[model samples]
Target: MAGSDSLFGFGKGPPALLLFLAGMLISNIGRSAYFVCVTWIALTWSNSARLVTILLFTSTLAQFLTSGVSGYFADMVDRRRLSVSLDVVRALVVALTGCAIAAKIGIWVLFLSVALYSVVDRGYLTAMQSMIPALSRRRSAIAANSASYLVMQAGTFLGALLAGYLLHTLPYGIGLFPIAIIFATSAVTLSAARTELSDPTHANSIYSKPRFQLRFMYHLGRHRLIAPTLIYSLGFGVGFLFSSLLAAYVLDEMKGGAVLFGQMESAWAFGAVLACLLLISGAGKLLADFGLAPLLFLSGTGLILLWMIPGPITAATLLVALGVIYNASRILMDARVQQTVGITEIGRTKGAINTAATGTGLLAFTFIAVAGDTLAPSDIFAQYGLLVIAVAAGFLLPALRGRPRSHDEDRSA
Candidate 1:
C-alpha cells in the first residue's frame, strides 16, 4: 500500500513525499507532546494563568519576528537542507531543556528554549509550505495539503495521548527525552528525501538581490483576493486561543486532571483529522465553489455554539465541529493562497499571512494575560467566539459583492 502510486495523489509515490510526510509526522508528534508537557509544567510551577499566557506570548512573538525573514529564505535557500538543519537544532534544544529539567533548573530556561525553538520552527514551516508546490504535480496541490494535514492531525492525536500517559506515570524529565529523540529521528528521516531545490520554475533567479523590499508588499496588496484573505487569516489565531486555554479549562472548570486534559486535546485532534479526511475525499470542491466567507461564517457559528453551552461534553462536541470548520477553512485558504501566488513569492506571501496571524495571537495573549485574573475561561471563550463572528460578518459583505475569481483571474491580479 505504501508503494502504491495512487496513494496520496502522487503518481509514483515519490520518496521525497514519503520522507517529507514521515518527518512531518514524527516532528509534529514531538512538538505536540512537548507543548502539552510545557503548558502543564508552567501551570504547575506558577499556578498563575498569566504566566501560561506569557509563555504562549513568547513563542508567538518569536514566530512573528522570524516569519518574514524565514519566508524570504524559503524562496532563496535550499529548503530541504534548511528543514533538516532546523529539526536537528530543535532536537538539541529539546535535549538541553531535558537536561535543565533534570538539574532542577528554573522555569525561565524552558521559556527561553521555547522562544528559540519557535524561531527555528517558523523557518522550517515556511520552507515546508514553499516546497509543497515543487514536491507534487500541480494538479495535486490540494490533495497533498490534505494528506499533510492528515499526518499532522494524526501526530497531534497520538502525541497528546502519549504525553498525557507519560506525564501521569513517569517523571517530568523522562517525558522530555521522547521529544528530543523524536526530533532527532525526524532529522534523519528528512535526510532520505530526494528534493530538487534548483527547479528553475520555483527558484528565485535573482537570489543575490535584497528580498526585504516594499515592492513585495505592493505586489501582494495589488491582488484583491490575497490582501483580504491574509487579513482574514487572523481569525485562525482567535480560533486557536482554545488550545492555549484548554489546560486551564480542564483543571479549573472541568475539575479534571492531566489525563482529562490530554483526552480533550486528543479529541480536538480527532476533529481535525475528520476535517482533513473530508478535504481529501472531495469536500474541497465546496470550498472552491463557495469561496471562504461561507466557511468562515460556519466556523464562527460553531464557536458561538461552543460558547452558548458550557460543559466538558458540550465543549468537546462543539470542538469537533469547530475543528472541522476551522481546519477545513484554514487548509482551503492556504491552498488557495499557494495556488494564487507565483512560485517566487509563495514563501514571502505565506510568511506575511503567518506574521499577521501570529501578531493577532500576540494581541489575544496580551488580552488573556491581563483579563484572566478577573474573567472566567467561559467568558473569554464566548468573547472570542463573538470576535470570530464579527470578523466573519465583516468579510461577508465583500465576498458577496465580489464574484469568486478563477485561477486565471487570481494569477492575473
Candidate 2:
C-alpha cells in the first residue's frame, strides 16, 4: 500500500499516514459511540426534545467561539503533539463526565464536559486535516483526504453499531467510560507515528509566520475560496438538522427507543462508509462534478421522505441514503480545500471554514432549542430539507478547485 499508486490513490503515501489513519479510526469510533450514548441519555434524563437541542447547542456554541483560534493553533505548533494532547484532554473530559453521570450529578456536568470536548475536538480535527498534506508524501491531497475520511466513516459505522448494541445491553452510564478509554488508546496510537514531511521547510512554514486573522473569512473572496467555503458551509450547516433532532425524530415520531435510534444511526454511518470507499476507489470521479447540489437535494429529499413516511424501517433506509449524500459532500469539500490551500495556510483556511460551519450549526441548534416544544422532529427535518432544496435550486458547484495538479492527482483515475 506504500507504493506510488496504492489503493488509497495517493501516490507515495508514507507509512506514518497509514498509522495516522489507523489512529483516526479508533478515535472516530470512540467519538461516535460516546455521542450516541450521551444524546440518548440526555433525552431519557430530561424527556424533552428542547433539552436535547439545548445540549447540542452548547457543543456548537463552544465550537463557534474557539474554532478560529483552534485553526491558528493548528498551524502554530506541532500538529501531531497538539492532537495527542487534545485527545488526552478529551479522554479526561469524557471519563470525568462518565463518573459524574454514574454519581447522578446535575446536567451541568454533562454540558460542561460537552463544551470542553467541543473546543478540543475542533482543534484536534483541524490539526488532523492540516497534517494530511505533510503526511501524504507531497501527493494528491484529495487522495489523502479520501483515505482518511474513508477510515473515519468506517469507524463511525462500527461505533454506531457498537452503540446500538451497547445501548440495549448495557447500563446508560456504563457506555460513556468506554469512549474515554478508546480516545486514550487513540492518543497512544497517534503518538507512535512520526510526521513524514518530505519538504520540511515549507511544510513547517506556518510555525515561523503564524496566521491569526479573522478577516480571512471576508477575504476568502480574494483567494477565490469564498464560494466553495460558503457552499460547503451551507452543506455542513444542514447536518445539524440531523444531529440535533434525529434522536427525537426516532423517539417521538418513529416511536422508537435507544436501540432503534442507534440502529438508524448505524445505518446512516454504514452508508457514509460506502460513499467514502467509492471515492477512495476513484469510482466517484464523475460525482465530483455533480457537486453539492445532488448531495443537498438527496439529503433534502431523504429527510422529507422520512417525514412523509414515518416508520423505523423507513427512517433507517432513508438515513442510509442521507448519510451517503452527506459524506460525499464532505469529501468533495475536504478535497477542494486541500487542493486550494498551501500547507502553511491550510490550517487557518480549514479553521475559518469550521468557524463559519459551526456558526450555522449554532443557529440550527438554537432554532430547534427554541421551537422544539411546538414542532415535531420530523416536521423540522422536512422544513430544513425544504430550505436546502430551495437553495439547491439556485446553487451550482463552487469554483473550489483549480486545474488538477500535474503530479499524481488523477493517477488512479
Candidate 3:
C-alpha cells in the first residue's frame, strides 16, 4: 500500500497525472503523424535524401536557437500555463500547416512550419520536465518519469503505424487533419489539469544578473556525478541521428517502401515502451545497480551491431535491442540528474544539458547531411557508433579509477 498511489507513485491518483499523460500521448501522436507525412512529402517531391536531411536540420536549428530561452522562461513562468500555451501554439501551427498544404504551398512553407513547431515543442518539453518535481514526491519522481516516457513511446509507435496506414490509403492533405485535431485535444487536456506554482526564493535576484545563468551552467558541469552523467547523455544524440537517417536507410539500402519504414519505427518505439514499463515496475533499480557506464557501453555496442546486420528481420531485431539499452541508460541518467539537482534549478540545469546535447546533435546532423551526398547511411551510422563507443570508454576510465587517499593517512603510517 505504501507505493500504491495510482499505480505509478503519483500521490493519491491526482487528476494532474492523468491529464499530463493524456497530453503527452496525444501530442506525441500528432508529432509522429506529422513527421511521417512531412518526410514522405519531402522525399516524394525531391526524390533525394539530402532534402530530407535539410528538413530535419531546420528542426535542429530551431531547437538550438530556442532551448536556452525556453529553459529560462520555464523556470520564471508558471509551468502549467506555459505547457498549455505551447500546446495551443502547436495546434495553431499544425492547423496552418494543413491549410498551406491544402492550398498547394511550396516546400519552404513546410520547412518553416516544422521549424516553428520545434521551437514551441522544445519549450513545452522543458516545462513538462520542470513540472514533475512539483507534482510528485522525491521518492516517486522516477516512477513519474517512467510513466510519462512510456506514454510517449506508445504514442510514437501507434502514431507511426497510423500515419503509414492512412498515408498509403488517403491523400496527403487529409492526413494532416487528424494531427491538428490531436494537437488541439492535447491542449484541452493539459489546460484542464491543476498545478501549484510556488515562487522561487531567489528568482528575482538571481535572474536579474544575466551573468549568473552562465555561472550556474559552469557550476553544474563541475559537479562530479552530474558532469559524467551529462557526458554520457551526449550519446543520446546519436540515437536521434540514427532516426533521421532511418527512412533513407530503409529505402536506399534495404530497398523497402513506406510500410516497411513505418514498421521499423514502430518496432523501435515498442522496444522503448517495454523498457519504460520495466523501469516503472522497478526493474530499473536492478539495471542501475550495475552502473551507468556498463549500460552505456553495451548500448553503443548494440548500435554498432545494427550496421553489421543485412536482412530486415535482423536489423529490426537489433533496433529493438538498441532501443532498450539506449532508453534504459537515458532514464537512469535522467533520474540521477533529478535526484542531484535542486527543484528550483531543475529547469535551468536540464535546459543547459539539453542545449549542449542538441547543439552537438545539430553539428552531427549537419556533418551527416553533407556527407549524405556521397557516403551511404550505413557508413555514417557506423562512424556514429564508433564515436559513441569511444566516448563511453573515455568516461568509463575515470569512473573506474579509484579515489585517491589523503596525504595525512600515508604520513601517519
| TM-score per candidate | 0.90, 0.90, 0.90
Candidate 3 accuracy as lDDT = 0.73
Candidate 2 residue spans exceeding 4 A from truth: 1-7, 11-14, 137-139, 195-212, 396-413
**Ten contiguous residues with the weakest lDDT in model 3:** 404-413
Clashes per candidate, residues 3 or more apart or on different chains: 0, 0, 0
Write the residue-wise lDDT of candidate 1 on 123-227 in tens digits.
888887777776655566667678888898899888999889978987887779889899999988987764543233345355324555323454356444454
Angstrom error at residue 261, model 3? 1.1
How large is the C-alpha RMSD of every model relative to the true structure? 3.3, 4.7, 4.5
TM-score of 1: 0.90
Q: Work out how many backbone clashes candidate 2 has.
A: 0
Model 1 residue runs over 4 Å out of place are 1-6, 194-208, 211-216, 225-231, 397-413
List model 3 lDDT by residue over 1-413, tens digit each: 36445457565455666777788898889888888778877777777777888888888889877777777777777887888889888888888887887788888877998899989999998888777776666776667678778998889888889888867877777778788888889888888765533223255545434565555455355433444444445567756666578888888889998899888888788878887988998886677666555666676676667677766998788777777776776666667667766766777777776777777778778887788659777777777778777766765665467654222111110
Q: What digit string (tens of lDDT, one per residue) describes model 2 on residues 104-201?
A: 88877778888999888888988887877665544455566777888998888888878877778877677777889999999998888755422232
Q: How far off is residue 106 in model 3, in Å?
A: 1.6
